[model samples]
Target: MAVPSGDQKPESYYVGVDVGTGSVRAALVDQRGTLVAFAEQPINQWEPQFNHHEQSSEDIWAACCVVTKKVVQGIDLNQIRGLGFDATCSLVVLDKQFRPLPVNHEGNSHQNIIMWLDHRAVSQVHRINETKHSVLQYVGGVMSVEMQAPKLLWLKENLRETCWDKAGHFFDLPDFLSWKATGVTARSLCSLVCKWTYLAEEGWDDSFWKKVGLEDLIADNYSKIGNQVLPPGASLGNGLTPEAAKDLGLPAGIAVAASLIDAHAGGLGVIGADVRGYGLACEEQPVTSRLAVICGTSSCHIGISKDPIFVSGVWGPYFSAMVPGFWLNEGGQSVTGKLIDHMVQGHAAFPELQAKATARCQSVYAYLNSHLDLIKKAQPVGFLTVDLHVWPDFHGNRSPLADLTLKGMVTGLKLSQDLDDLAILYLATIQAIAFGTRLIIEAMEAAGHSISTLFLCGGLSKNPLFVQMHADITGMPVVLSQEVESVLVGAAILGACASGDFSSVQEAMARMSKVGKVVFPRHEDKRYYDKKYQVFLKLVEHQKEYAAIMKGD
Candidate 1:
């Protein structure tokens, strides 16, 4: 493809690539962090067996190339100063020749990636947790089936011949992309500190790996995983390799910054913005007062403190995880947007809802929002779900409780199965997610982090009802970033920092990020939600009780 000649292109432009669970997206952002052009392409996934989600590193890189090329189609190549990538904290396996290794028993080498949502390692996670190792403390005092260690142990035990024995290098998806880009073996601190139990100060823990029965990694001085670790936004090697530059349609040797996990990128994209003009409590307070909720397929409630605040069942207190010079605490729901989709789409009235949504040229969610308003007439939307309550852990709880075995529960069912039923269920699910966020907040405060402002971004944040519900339930103003694609912008901020256009990630965030709209909690509705939140707690408690009775407790 020939580069288009435009009238005086900007002095510098950065490209941001985000690989979420479903799709890969690329955005061309200017030096000021404004998105100039964007494109997306879906990545492929395979489920060879139950609870096993896998992808191909080859396919992901190809999708990245396609989106990046399309987004920069008409831009001058010389104007592109740097590039950055952020992906889900999924694990990628490769052999000595940098070839994909089968992560599944099917022996499909193309499906070499173990997805972030995959839970085939539950047995492994349980065994590791039984050890109660000190390294487990960093990951919320208990390792969820999602982290790399559990997955690694599972591979060592189950897929030894198919994967473990053949695998030469292991990579979190973000580090895989950087290695693919610059041929650098260095891993991002963001990935290691948050997901791999790599302490920022002490590096890798040999005893932890040995105790976990994966001492093979320590044999080569941690070469298979990562030896040279760099912080996010730090430039790697000389720059992009000739092959990667060709695939991405960019100049060779352009700056490529160390990457971040997708959610942390969203945190970086919004949390550090100076909110002085927003008239929120955080305006007078510090960045510590703002909590960034990157809500997408899952929701991660990210907050930073000047010092470590240990909140049990919540991940972090990790230094420089999201923002440099701060201790990061992350609480999350394993399912939020995905839960809403599952509940809405599985309803009997979904066909009618889809038809109505298509006829109105609106999304199903948009149609539902309007439908709820019509039903409520003059009443607040929260009132529609007065009798209906949802527990929202269909995919398991990620925070406060940190229990993967806990299943979702829905109370107040009726014989009436219609559009109204679907709408109310939808409303209840969103409220459940909001209450989960509140639980995380209460835990944080109990641990001594004063969070007064809520910052939201991601696909779910685009829904007005979802945003408003979070504000009302939490009783805090929710700040929305001016840029809707804040994850991409966060990746670009890393690029901007690597390009030397900004001094640090903090400076880059404050300069490039801006607050657009603020949703304030309605005090009048506070009493109502306070009561519903109680019911939310009881549903979980009762579910646990039922499980115990069934098991002959």
Candidate 2:
């Protein structure tokens, strides 16, 4: 690792590590939030049952080390002033010796992680929801199976011997990463407020825990989970421990900040873009006027306000989860990018389409976009999805609806096995996902949020059609950051805050992040999208009616 030729300050470089669903990524960023180096290593995931997803703590940490080492390969380690981490809200189970504890039904102790997407806790979630506890208000009056409590309850009921008896600690993935780095077992307020049932104003509701039948956690002073909570971007301990430093190939005692959930990091990365001159509602308005959409395998819509607002089916009013001192309202889609992938790749023409894509040196999505244009010309309306519609809930709805049992739907399918049909289906799928976002936006607005601009990041932001569709559907300007991987940049902002380079998280966000492009809603496409939106609602309504009839409701 060598320093570049310049008189740059020693504290210019900061490191940010993000543990995503499939990979661990590391980035070295400067004071200006400019990424100087980046690296990634895939992590392992295990699916032992239909609704179970698990991973290894050892494998994840190893991948983190590999990526951290690679990103700093040609950089000056001494200049690396601070570090921060962000990760999925997956549950990590460990024993008294800090060894992995089996989270699966089988006795495979090496699979220590219970992924956030695992739905084995559905029954538990339903039971918890049935209680009608006051704490449920903060979580949209319905605790999702994706949250920690349901998953913990599932462990207690199903895998009593392997999980319940042996589990000594339950760390949200971000907190686990921080504990590994600094040897501090304190949980992050971001994770607790957003995922776990910790209320910022009243702290843990002991009654809720007891009623849920897992009083052992409360009896133990909640030590196995989290006894202490710190806000995102707060400095953690003195720095990295000697062992963690050795593993990461970095110097000991460098500052390490408390962590954020991955999607919130993307919110911190893009939501503060300078919109004053952009003539958007977020320009001179409070952060509440802007919504941050982190679109990846899933999508999270984050809005912050100084005062808490309780919106049904939205996952917050969590205090200080993203921006400090702001109450966050989190709405999301369980599947966005993943749904698009499934729709396109699962089609009959996939093989021929993929071959055509490769021959043109294009991504399958890109090739499909081009093919969609050709299909539109063949249609009388010159629009690929004029008669087609899709409900983008292949993995269940996460927000506004919050119905995990609801399945996906497709309308206006013809008996054609042509690539044009596939392309139109793809276009319709993308539009459906965007419309889902609109549904969330409308829900938030009805609950008193005046969101006028959307800050988008992640894989879906790279798709022009997707981005434009979001703009047209939501009827708001979409702002994208200059740095494509704003999640990593957001993590780096925490590092900068920890290093004392910035006095506060807000200052770091303002200094490091900048907006690159803006997409305005297309006025001409308004009527088309509106008509399709009505169809989208009808599809869901019809499905609900069918369910009611079948269930004798």
Candidate 3:
């Protein structure tokens, strides 16, 4: 990647840093959103126990510095105009002196991050749900165990001396990154409204806080969480601090924009792609007709509207959460890529299948897909999933049903431990995950979302079979972004907005994002999937019935 000529001004370059569940990625993007250089460094996560995941704030920041420096090496550091960050909405705990505070019971302060998937606070979440607060309506009327308040309450109850007494600040990871960069403690409304129970319209709900036994946060006037809330693209105080600038190997005063949750950044990156010539509904209709699907370890379905639409079991009605002034309704599958990995790698024939894949210079998944195709060819009629079905809720359902206790269900399993069987299971798993997306879309439409096109990003979008499966299952055209890392591009847009490169996020999105290709549904396969979807629904309905009978309900 070559740097621009010296005549180009310093404000021409922008940096977008994204902190995912396991890595911190940095991209050097131009004013037009072209990525010049990019780097990534893996961060450590500890699963001390089942359902408990944690990370270190000190370590994450160290990685941020390492990757940012690596990405900008040999480039004119002075030409880097602004920086923006997006991160998983994990909870970060720190002491008054900015030392790590233990978010776990073992008193290991280095494990200060309560990961977004951690369910250690399940009991706390249940207790909070009992309060029946009005603020809960925004979060689909049921606060998740994944949210910060429940985790905070759990820490306060179980690790009171180690965490509660010593903890002086609580931050969503995005805000934590910004504070680390600029020494500014203000939080972005994007993180607060989306993760924490900070209502955009009503601000922090004091009555709800008191009801949930977290009134201490309210007592401090919410300073520890965030006293000053700014929009996603607003500039933080006084740009980057001298100390941080030195640490990052950049100039002292580049703008640092308020941040966004990682998935929301993905939404911003693709949601605004030029649909004018694409023949999509967003091309002829309003922006509300498009749904942005950010697929990775998890998947979030983002639908924006002019008015707040409260869809039950969805995550929002969050005002200006993604695009400013438009409400965001976020639905998600807690496991997609993770589920596929579990399904494929956990099989008895995985080692042999992996060996075959290595010999062919193909991924194990690709090998499985090929084997599934062979099996389909052998069948005289019907599809690969003619009998097999999978429920794909190994990590629990995050949307539509909001059922965390739902376990994965697999039907049509044979005692044969052959690679072909593994392939069938793999195909079934893919179809199941796609069906889950369809279920979310159906639920959203039932509640008034006029979704017409599906825009996808992240790791799963690269898979041809997965992309086609989503298109086929949803019966909607799937649009891919020209920039492969749309999440990174989205984060860069924030820096672009803060540097005044664009007048607003809408303009920044329009200029910086572009569509690459479209995957249309296989019209001939509609009946095949429709029948399979019926079996998929029956698997869940049957699971519910069995559970009810066992409980004598």
lDDT of 1 by residue, 1-553 (tens): 2333687554678999999988999999876668889899998988888789999999999999999999888777888888999999999999988999988877889999999989999988888898899888888899889889999998889889988998899999999999999999899999999999999999899999988898999978899999999989999899999999999998899999999999999999898776877788888888899899999999999999999888899998789987888989999998898899999999999999999999999999999999999999888889998889999999777899999989999999999989999999999999999999999999999999999999999989999999999999999999998889999999998888888888999999988888889999999999999999999999999999999999993
On lDDT, the stronger of 1 and 3 is 1
Measured by TM-score, how close is model 1 to the native structure? 0.98
Reference-based TM-score, model 2:
0.97
Q: Quote each prediction's TM-score.
A: 0.98, 0.97, 0.96
Candidate 1, residue 479: Cα displacement in angstroms equals 0.6
Error of 3 at 78 (Å): 2.4
User: Model 1: clashing residue pairs?
Assistant: none
**Model 2 lDDT tens row, 110-199:** 898999889899889999999998889999778888999999999899889877888889999999999999999988899999998898
Report the error of model 3 at residue 405, Å.
Answer: 1.3
lDDT for model 2, please.
0.88
The per-residue C-alpha lDDT of model 2 at residue 211 equals 90
What is each predicted model's overall lDDT from 0 to 1?
Answer: 0.91, 0.88, 0.88
Q: Write the residue-wise lDDT of candidate 3 on 1-553 in tens digits.
A: 4554678644478889999886899999886677888898999999999999999999999999998998889887777778999999999999988888988768888999999999888889989988888888999878878888899899889988878978889999999999998999999999999989887777898888788888898866887788899999899999999999988887888999999999999998898878777666668878889999998888899999999888999988899988999999999988888888888889999999989999999988778767766777655222777888899988778898888888999988788999878877888888899999999999899989999999999888987788889998899999999888889999999988887778999999988888999888887888888999999999999989999999994
TM-score, candidate number 3: 0.96
